[model samples]
Target: MTTSRTVPSVSVTYARNGGSTKSNELGMRVMQERAYEKRGEQYLLIKSPPASGKSRALMFIALDKLANQGLKQAIIVVPEKSIGSSFADEPLSKFGFWTDWTVTPKWNLCNAPGEEGGKVNAVETFLNSDDKVLVCTHATFRFAVDKFGVEAFDNRLIAVDEFHHVSANPNNKLGQHLGEFIARDKVHVVAMTGSYFRGDAEAVLAPHDESRFDTVTYTYYEQLNGYEYLKTLDIGYFFYSGSYADDILSVLDADEKTIVHIPNVNSRESTKDKHREVEHIIDALGEWQGTDPTTGFQLVKTPEGRILKIADLVDDEASKRDKVSAALKDPAQKNNRDHVDIIVALGMAKEGFDWIWCEHALTVGYRASLTEIIQIIGRATRDAKGKTRARFTNLIAEPDASEEAVTEAVNDTLKAIAASLLMEQVLAPRFNFTPKTPQSGPVDGFDYGEGGYDPEKSNVGFNEESGQFQIEIKGLAEPKSKEADRICREDLNEVIAAFVQDKQALERGLFDGEHAGGETLPEELTQVRMGKIVKDKFPELDDEDQEAVRQHAVAALNLTQKAKEIAVTGPDVEKGNTALIDGVRRYAMDVRELDIDLIDRINPFGEAYAILAKTMSEESLKQVAAIISGKRVNLTPDEARELARRAVRFKQERGRLPSVTSPDPWEKRMAEGIAFLARMKAEAENA
Candidate 1:
């Protein structure tokens, strides 16, 4: 196999303080304790990373709600039956809690052997009975709500796990049911998810409905930093020319425990023969021995004499695949490092499939949504004893100039980049931005680095324990309403998700630069495009609130990119744990000032493009740019209006309208916007 030429787009090293794994008096970890503290809230949303004790967190809160809060019953809804295993009987009392969590065998409809339609009856029976908890899939819950109506499940707790499955779209039954439940307002609802945003860019909840829930957010930085092991997590993508299996071994290290998710049959990367592909992967590994009789795991001896126990979940044979699946999920071998080495799957092992020993999650194609990508990354992030580092690699097919589906290939490339960008934001430390003012000072717990809270300029402060950055940016807009403030504080990443996923913004940002003759200006994306996205997304927010959200979202995204660029290229790159924090401070110092305009002036995807250039072949990169540039259209009336607004703001601040001859690219672009509008007006009047 040829050696792979791929660099990690985002490599984050943690302090490994062991704080997250430590249990409190009630046997709750840090995140669980945090979630349990808000157990009394009628509407609670838990936004925590995978394996940060989200399962136990729900148990702790559900128990409290039942015993102390007068809730009659708890219905735990999960995305799939496999995840239902997470809510299985937990002996909390053995771990020093007041009570143990137990679900009646029959009431646990997920384990019931039947279609979801049949399980709705079990849900109805359980609701009528005195059982404290009933665990079922989201489907069963939806069907039950449909048959019995929302009022039948009153005075109970509805805990939706993997809550990102619900969407605010009217077509999404779960979201519609949730809205009805909230409108009824008799039941307490607790929603939990590692990714709150949908891959399809649908809102998880309506604004008015979302505002009612008290949010408990636990950052990925805090979870990974406090781990006892697993000091580093690397996320990257690789571009391959031919079939993916031939290039699989280039990035797949046999010794590390890994999950290889082959491309779907319809995906461009797939060779269309999954079984043969699996056989090919097995053959490439080494001489394959017979399947293990007891476990059904295919045993192979590498040339180095190491035996690799591989689980093949892609097989179409149900009995054989079931045995392999059962072997992987066997509780007796959960912590045994040698239980399984590699899991090759097509549609399994993604959401809630746990194998703590996984050191690499290699996916063959771009997943359908960012939520899936986050879930796949979570597979490799679980802290294990010997797993000091874990990485997630997306092996994608490079766009070929000879292919008829080159446009589709380019779209996949853009989507992959978008996923990478969002994951960086998700994994990095949270940012708390305030407008730089004379009254600004360092917060109580934050350390302002060497200079220690310089009031004369915008400063960057970091609170290591909380894994949050305190930033002051000049001319930053602050949200006026409580809902808007909550969004700015807690939902900036969600905003960034929508922004990066915007096709127009992403297309222009990635390909419209020097390769496409440099006609696209940064302000068009940062201001007009992003401005339109924010307005359409949160129509409830007024102009100032929208601008505030826009500024905060853009600043957070751009600063993270800037910090990553500094951290990776800095002189002290070896100190990866502190590189990001130091990079943020160093950037602020280098620029001499931090402001919204300066942040917006920088292309959010510039560094991404630089990384893309390094990874993809020069020829393939040019093909993608050519395909995107060919589709570029002239400015729309809406775009002109947005830029004209920015021009108005520019004139107010600089005492003159932007001139076409201005040396500044942004000023010249604003002038072009004015000219476009004027030309349109003249033509309309003449017509």
Candidate 2:
């Protein structure tokens, strides 16, 4: 009894919780609480998901600094005019905050009609006066800065929302202005953004500058998984053979609250006629009741004579623009918020536009950017009164082999699929892990050779009571090497999977590209000789990329070996489990949904190894550094206990165990012994 729409969709699954509404009443939300904790820091970057209350968090911190911390002024800058409303004044006391957030109407220069000079003059007036908060668009801020210069706003707090608009490129005006502000060192900055990681896939700030700020990341998982009403969000793709407008009726629900985005004007798939498409959809719905003047809703009569209300944001008339925008925001004349059935928009409602009742966000075209897709998806994720679930459906055209643009269309579709998979990874819960057991010596029957460490030999398990996912690894210094090994192995696996999946991989001749016909190597020699072949094949790749290919080949060989070895262990032994050996440690994966396919699907940011290398957490960096420094060891219980006894004896004899002032060999050894003893005791107690 399932329909065509249900059959063609791919299910997107992720971890979620029952939901939380503590923030709905105001005061400080979970994320805002995190911000308030870091209020004392000079530079703060709040990386949070959209609709997670970053604006209110900034208000709380800015007010605290302006009223109590002696900051001269606070300037709030947004990327667009509609976003400026997010900073509108709020009665804080009613919401349990100490003071109200006040923005004078005169200083709020968003969407004010005039040229660059007029906006600059307005900024000048605000700066000259005693206004504590001035809100303006990023364009206006740029013009004002050009006219008044950076020194005019010295000692003030500049809080930039949607901080991803800034990038390393010199052509990006806001980015350049932020760099200058950082260089001057006169202003304190609080940069906030929902799309900080993937916008343009470019550095938002220079490495040295980005390092100066203390960052607080509120992941998409934390926000959605903690919601009170909404439980699940499904992101799926539906492909059609013809025009999206013609195929629209197959996937869209007329009864559901939905926003339908037509194809971009420049897209090859676009008919270049949005109005006709709108008309076609309206005709399919029912009879036309004409536009309602009172509420600005376009009323239509269905074949059943049922009237359907639509908000036509694509209307080009300048006069209707304001009315349409207002109606889109509220959509209710007498508190009937859900009166509008469908909102057909061109480009108006993508970012920073809040409509709480939307249940479906439908887009008809390929958008290459993952950041843009995430923003579009966020529109339907807002928790509402009766909304229990949400969906994001992408309607893309399937490639036609007979068509002239088939090659390009096929490539674009593959890229979109890759981006969708990557988004799932980003939105899903991350795995965080620490060593659960101390490393023991090498186990019997286990081999590190090409035929040794197979999938069958690998041991992985989940402890329901403790909520831990455990994996067994070889060698003692396992704790120190766990993170590095996991990262290297996973990254290498991804590269190999991409190599196998991509048609371009063979066309590029990644393997045997430069090799001429010669004597065939033996089957066993193929694995042994693949690295040199890969390195020689892609000579155009830089040293790093070349090295990655070689690493991928090696990793594939090792994985095959593991799988074979695990097979030899027999079916009686559980998968992913091996007998405990000396120098082996048990590690726990803190992430959920660890899948090989998911790992391979992250398509953006060219090399997986490079991205992981650049974005490792401080603790992970320390672990990697320690492993690289060759300082990790597998200590036995006897050794750990003896070290502890010796440390105690030393302290009693000398009144102090060691001194960090000097790099003396004996002091360093004593310190290491004492630390190892403490670690062993802690491990034993936890066990």
Candidate 3:
């Protein structure tokens, strides 16, 4: 049997306050109520976690638009037919709302039996008719918009669900069409998404277009913290060797209600024969009894003599798969915890697939898209009675030095690390940073540790009710422009997503320390690398604005890492929901003062490397380090220019240029950058 080792990258505990699930007088949950308050805005974006009632939120807003806002109609656009069911009719009046959300059966194109191209006539018919709401897939809407110009859909509220599917890339038809509609300025638009950033590093909307929309953000910390159940959520990955089927039992607990996503046929980890793999997994469990006729679930008796009802969605046979799919989606059984034990799927049960009792989400290989990973994790995050813990596990193949695919395996490993880092930021509490001036004081709602806020040093204050951290860092660059401030408040995660995904930055940060040639200074990645990424991501911003964003993003990432290190290593490992909060306070108290320079000196990936050492085999770890170290890269001209810019800032503040002989590593690195850039200019002049 192949050995299986799993390490949880992030295990967050929540408060279980039950505030999110509780509804207001209008029967709107916390997030939904917040979104409803902004219904008057013509352009709005709802960024909330899954199972946070985004569908109901849209219903509340869409109904208001129809009855009160004087809008002609509401078009709900979803990425797939499965997600289209989210916009189904709701009896809002029964829940204290003034009106109901109804989409006429004929106008619900998702349930209709025709191709998207053939649905254009229905869209035209609905526009000409008095139907208040229409629901369809993104494909159907794209085709309809192509057939009918932007002018044809005027005076309507177009609500896009899974908004991340629409990209700012010119090639993205839906995104292009949405831009056209915004330019026309004739219709109202509302976009909702569980994850705002895409895994492929593309913007969902252009800067100017995104700025037009008033954003309503409900972070994962807030959503999970306010839950009635699911107190802890663990995100982890396992590395396995040889066929995954042989090692499946190591991580796949038969007691937990899990959804195992087998690898795609094209993925390197796949054995190429999916059917055989499924049979192997079943056999590994125990004796297989006959299939249940009604649910079409395969009955397998585990070693403990308990029968397991597993839904096999990997089968290509349409009749068999459809029966299993129908049974899984049966609304009557949604609340029944024992309805299904495990689900083995290939491409289904990811987006919009709801299984509230799922204790774990397990996948065989690394998913290329971070958005996909987030959605898969969401499947297990639903709050169910007695289910206090939910976890997501990724089973990846370990790299082998003898294999030709070693390089490919290394890339997958890096991508998996990137995904873990991004998820950590997403799951952490929201950070509100401010410069530490002489007049700095504690915010109104925040709790400033045991001794209260200090006047002489930086303070870390946490507001449990708001699920936010008010941190005062000395020398933190404050954003001047409104747009820059908005980004620092709302889009720091998006900025971090780009930074962690950078190939060079991730490579160096992960494996280029003492094991490799030279030690990578924290400022090299935090200042020069992140600075370049921010400038490229938002070219519209001025130099000062760009620096402000860079500082904020770096501080957020590094502080979280520092906090996690303290929490995990501290005596009280199970500190419950307040672990992170306590960790931050402890870190602040341990240091003399919290400053931007001290924060930048921290390697954001240090905690990650420590965890990696504990989980991966020493030999395999060395192999990965060797593979990455083989491709040692010199500083590029772009990096040199970015560092030189930093050197200039250093000179302005310290009254002298950074010295190569300086004891400080950051100062020496800046001096080296200046030398590198000067040498390049000299060589260019000679050429």
The lDDT values for all models are: 0.91, 0.60, 0.91
Clashing pairs in 3: none
Q: After TM-score superposition, what is the CA distance of residue 182 in candidate 3 from its true location, in Å?
A: 0.4
lDDT-based ranking: 1, 3, 2
What is the Cα-based TM-score of model 3?
Answer: 0.99
Task: Please write out the lDDT profile of model 3 over residues 1-687, one tens digit for every residue.
Answer: 655478899999999999888988888989999999999999999999989999999999998988899999999999888788888888998988887788788888888997766788899999999878899889989989988899999999999999999999999999999999999999999999999579899998889999999999999999999999789999988898888999999999999999999999999999999999999999998899989999999999998999999999999999999999999999999999999999999899998999999999999999999999999999999999999999999999988888999999989888888889999999999999999999888789899988998899899999998899999999999999989999999999999999999988888887885423457888889998999999999999999999999999999999899889999989758878888889888998899889999998887887888887777777888898887777867778898889899999998998999999999878988898899999988999999
How high is each candidate's TM-score?
A: 0.98, 0.67, 0.99
TM-score, candidate 2, is 0.67
* lDDT tens per residue, model 1, 1-687: 433387789999999999989999889998999998899899999999888889899999999999999999999999998898899899999988999999888888878998877798888888888879999999889999999999999999999999999999999999999999999999999999998468999899999999999999999999999999899999999988888888889888998999999999999999999999999999989999889999999999999998899999999999999999999999999989999999999999989988999999999999978999999999999999978999999999988888999888988999999999999999899999999988888899999999798989899999988999999999999999998899998999889999999999999998896534557878788899999999999999999999999999999999999999998899869997889999999999999689999999888988999999899888888878877788888789899889899999999999999999999988987898899999999999999
Q: What local lDDT score does residue 282 receive in model 2, on the 0 to 100 scale?
A: 81
Deviating ranges (above 4 Å) for candidate 1: 1-4, 514-517
Best by TM-score: 3
Clashing pairs in 1: none
TM-score of 1: 0.98
